[model samples]
Target: MVRAGFLLSIFLSMALVPASARASDPDPWFGHDKFLHFSVSNGLAAGGYAVSSLFWEGRTERLIAGGSFSLALGAAKELYDMTGRGDPSWRDFTWDVIGTATGLALAWGIDELFFRSDARKPVEAAATPGGLAIRW
Candidate 1:
């Protein structure tokens, strides 16, 4: 379904990283720059979700908005790097994707736990002559 397609697209995008970028990346996966990319992307994704929530009622829509916003910025940064301003590294983009997913999941969890208006209402219980009756 839609989930399968989404996952496939993610994997395909990762696979599409240019060979030149991969070959020229002298950066370590655990470098400080990678940490920065991860943290910043995480924050951006969460913030995007938070902002999108004000206008969208659907969880899927919010998630898409947040993820797309974060990933677009990550792609933009890599494209900028490719323009000779900095070293372009697909590893950085990979960290960005990981961070974006983490942030979106965290935000979705928080929204479900605390902000969901469609959550079930509290059950009511009444004592009957023979037993307790509950109404949802």
Candidate 2:
């Protein structure tokens, strides 16, 4: 009987503790965090796009890969923040998405404006007796 009563009291206390610990005030630095999230996501997206462009021939493929990487990184950070120290905010995620899009657009614009003409044209591959040969 004593053990049962003790366990019941412990459960009641655990439930009530969280209710009292809830804060009534808003965070002071909420706006700054959104900007930080945007800048970090933007830089990450631009870097991902730049590196992927070096390996991918198709523009659509490179954009998709870069965007996916950037969004995944943001999601990972948000999930990590949810553990204890920080709460996940959808507003910050919205900024991250916007920043990633901006970064991708910038990368595409730079590539199209400056590097398009510098690329070597691809040559058609010819099928030979033993294998296919490609000329650039």
Candidate 3:
């Protein structure tokens, strides 16, 4: 719960930056490029979570891995843009963060809803007439 509140606060602050501060910015928040950033970040985050699940057993570790992977890629993109290939926009990064959070939340919720029970159930083995049967 504390983590959720903290994340919410960060998101709100990023989203609510004053209009006056962005008055001279060329990039619009609702631009098509922003959409791409959001979508790519979302996909990357979910993919990272799925990949990390193969290595990590804990939910928190998986979430961190996924979120960090997405954010690192976003930052790398921004850094590349800073090298004169394209315009670097904080708005794009903000969208990336939002998308990452959304993707992580959806993936985590799906995991909890669909996979939690299976993980929690204990495995049992019983001896049959011919062999041993294993069940979870």
| Per-residue C-alpha lDDT of model 3 across residues 72-115, encoded as one tens digit per residue | 99999999999999899899999999999999998999899888
- Which segments of model 3 are wrong by more than 4 Å? 1-25, 117-136
Quote model 2's TM-score. 0.63
lDDT of 1 by residue, 29-63 (tens): 99999999999999999999999999999999999
Report the CA-based lDDT of candidate 3 relative to the real structure.
0.91
Q: Which residue pairs overlap in candidate 1's backbone?
A: none
Instruction: Output the better candidate (1/2) by lDDT.
Output: 1
What TM-score does prediction 1 earn? 0.71
Q: Clash totals for all models, in order?
A: 0, 0, 0
Between prediction 2 and prediction 3, the one with superior TM-score is 3
lDDT of each: 0.92, 0.82, 0.91
- Please provide, for model 2 over 18-133, each residue's C-alpha lDDT reduced to its tens digit, 9 standing for 90 to 100: 99999974533357887888888888888888899889977778788778989999998888879986878777788889889988888788877777743555766786778867
> CA lDDT of 123 in candidate 2?
66
Q: Which number leads on TM-score?
A: 1
Q: Candidate 3: deviation at residue 35, Å?
A: 0.7
Candidate 1 Cα lDDT to native? 0.92
